[model samples]
Target chain A: MTGKLTVVGLGPGSPQQVTPEALAAVAEATDFFGYGPYVDRLDLRPDQRRHASDNREEMSRAAAALTLAAAGGSVCVVSGGDPGVFAMAAAVCEAIEQGPDAWRGIEFAVVPGVTAMLAVAAKAGAPLGHDFCAISLSDNLKPWSVIETRLIAAAGAGFVMAFYNPVSKARPHQLPKAFEILRAHLPGTVPVIFGRAAGRPDEAIRVVPLSEARADMADMATCIIVGSAETRLIARDGNRPLVYSPRSWDAASAGKR
Target chain B: MTGKLTVVGLGPGSPQQVTPEALAAVAEATDFFGYGPYVDRLDLRPDQRRHASDNREEMSRAAAALTLAAAGGSVCVVSGGDPGVFAMAAAVCEAIEQGPDAWRGIEFAVVPGVTAMLAVAAKAGAPLGHDFCAISLSDNLKPWSVIETRLIAAAGAGFVMAFYNPVSKARPHQLPKAFEILRAHLPGTVPVIFGRAAGRPDEAIRVVPLSEARADMADMATCIIVGSAETRLIARDGNRPLVYSPRSWDAASAGKR
Candidate 1:
């Protein structure tokens, strides 16, 4: 094939945050493929072929993109966040590997984009200042038992957490259950920042005590940030509360300058 | 002051990854300030002023940069990874507040850059496919007790972890000690990927089981990735060892395509 394939990250929410490189990659592609919601973000011309489907069909979608590339069409496989982070980059690579003839001579490139974790962390004022981890509560691929064991281990290890896919339409209670598991080991006063659609229109970011986080407050797109015991919400003048996990502090230290 | 300030992220590693917009911001700046290593990445003209320091002194350096900006110097506060992620962005905002003069009149903007967590995660395949967290291990600002607690929480929560500052010259044993704490709660077979100076010359990325991650294997510049129970290293032909943390999977009965 004379064509190439480029996987582009559309960034966490807005087009403004999309890097110029990602924009160029998409603009240069003759065919664009991605999740349905992600494809909605682009304004395509009449000649460009746009293909999108539910996230569940990522493998097939990726395979289709490669097939198109193999036919000598430059294709862009786009993702909402950085393609490598819980996105379609690997799936595309896997698809390519599974079908030797699909994209035999097609060169592939994975472009990085801003991810939800960083966007939510920024919106929440650095709750990820120290060591933290991200976990998805969705059990579609793995059993809940395995997730529970990992949660217990993470909580005991005292890592801050960014929860992706904490809740979805079918599994509304997953977040509360996850929180209960965490509360069992962490202090009740530990902070939790819930960020919905971070960096997008109607973005909502709130800081609440771990004891106060409710199941109804989140959805598939929400990013839940649960802080360790040392994380604190520092209130600044007339600004959003800044959440930060202290990395270090001298007991004899002076106040903020 | 007639000057402006722009805070930019150089992205994780590699000059090729640096976005053109970020480069433009740097090119236009009369004074460049950032962590010592990041500032060294750019080729500078003789007239360009550079300010560099260790990561711990980010706040101090930011404060100094703000002072310079207030005195009419167009300053570019640069960071290796995205400036907003555990970098100098917050410090710049805080310093602006602490300055003798309000910087509200100064044109200030933050340019997004690639982050180490994303870069390392890409290189290792997809260890962060599910939920993950990024935390710095430097206790220079917080107590080790806090770090220990967060580590436990993250581990207990089943969140993959990207550890920054795994070790340092003065604190060579912290990484191993952290590993011990994690091992106490997690299975010894859990995988840990150590990325040293990722994207830079002499970059090294190694995947080892938790039981084999020794203190001597890491240092301050290393970004350590510890996988959740679901994470596994899959051998791929000619493409290096790939790490995959499956988020969802079809029934084994479906058969691998």
Candidate 2:
């Protein structure tokens, strides 16, 4: 069969952020499957069918996409950022593992896109230029204890961290505990960035010290960046300050020009 | 001043991967600054000027881009992948921190792109569908000791890791040491992926057990992914195997079928 299932990441927000590969996939696919918001973002044509489902139903959505592809249809599974990063790519593979053996014969491909944390890092200076980790703080899939252990290990190891799902109405207290864990291992002077709705028109990026980081500063739309020891702030004469980590770590880096 | 310093990531090696935002920035730029190879990739017009330099001279290249922007020329500093990921965004911000005070007054924005690690992860199924970290193994900027420590910590914390610059001729032994460190914590069966020249025509991806991973498997063009303890492999029916990590975890997840 010529049927195929291609997973595409449309990127965070702006239309300009969508790559030509994603656009081309949308054009070629007979069906698009994804969360409601991402499916709504696709440029739908009369010939294209869309299966927009709730955000939490990733497995079911992936199974449906696979079913269509196995029946000789070109399907595209869309994600907000890159499909591989805590997104539908895993779900699609999981579906293949659990579904009918015939589904495994279908062709599958993943198309990457700009993830939110990188976009947030760009908006706020380059706090992630050094050794870094990305962790989702929500305990929806895993235990909160795992998140805590990862946080302490990440902080103690001096890795800059970009936190996704830092705060949500369902899991509000996790960010505060995370900050406390990091603060215990890191200095209070470490730079922390709260980027809300990055790449969107109302995007707001706030840079603060770890000591000043409050749980209230984050939400589901926010991504937090807690910098390593080398993260620095450049105070401009009459402009907003820029936060960045130098490329090199040496004695010379400690002294400013 | 009409000058603006826009740092854009070219998104690995594919034209289709380049976002419209990066293309727009390049089109509007009067002066393009980057490594010789990346600059050659751009479709430069006669009215536009190009300043390509060696890969190691990031600081000077960034200073030049800022200097041109400060002098009323639209400048674009290019990185092969996402600028925020061990690339020119930090260097451009570093140049601003150390350059003339006038350079600080120039407007600068970082446009994100599809980074190499994400592209690699996409090619190798969804190995990074869980919490992960990215660490650059080149000791050019940071010490090997730092790399060793981070590797141990990341492994102990059970983070799937993407290693960039895993094996350069100058740093041949580092990847082996990294594998040794990870082997102490993870199983020998943990799947490791080496994605060489991802998104390019010469692209190749290799998946092997951690026990079998060799330093020669990687080069400067390779991006490596060392999966967590939970990573899995699915044997295809007369096809290549698929590597992916499931979205679920814990005792409760086992009964989902």
For model 2, the superposed segments whose C-alpha errors exceed 4 Å read A250-257, B251-257
**TM (B chain), model 2:** 0.95
Among these predicted structures, which one has the highest lDDT?
Answer: 2
Error of 2 at B128 (Å): 1.0
lDDT tens readout by residue for model 1, B42-76: 77888898888876787789878877787788899
* Residues B213-251 of candidate 2: C-alpha lDDT, one tens digit per residue: 888888888899998877788878877678887776654
Clashes of each: 45, 0
Superposition TM-score, candidate 2 onto the true structure: 0.95
Report, in order, each candidate's fnat: 0.43, 0.90
Worst-scoring 10-residue span by lDDT in model 1 chain A: A248-257
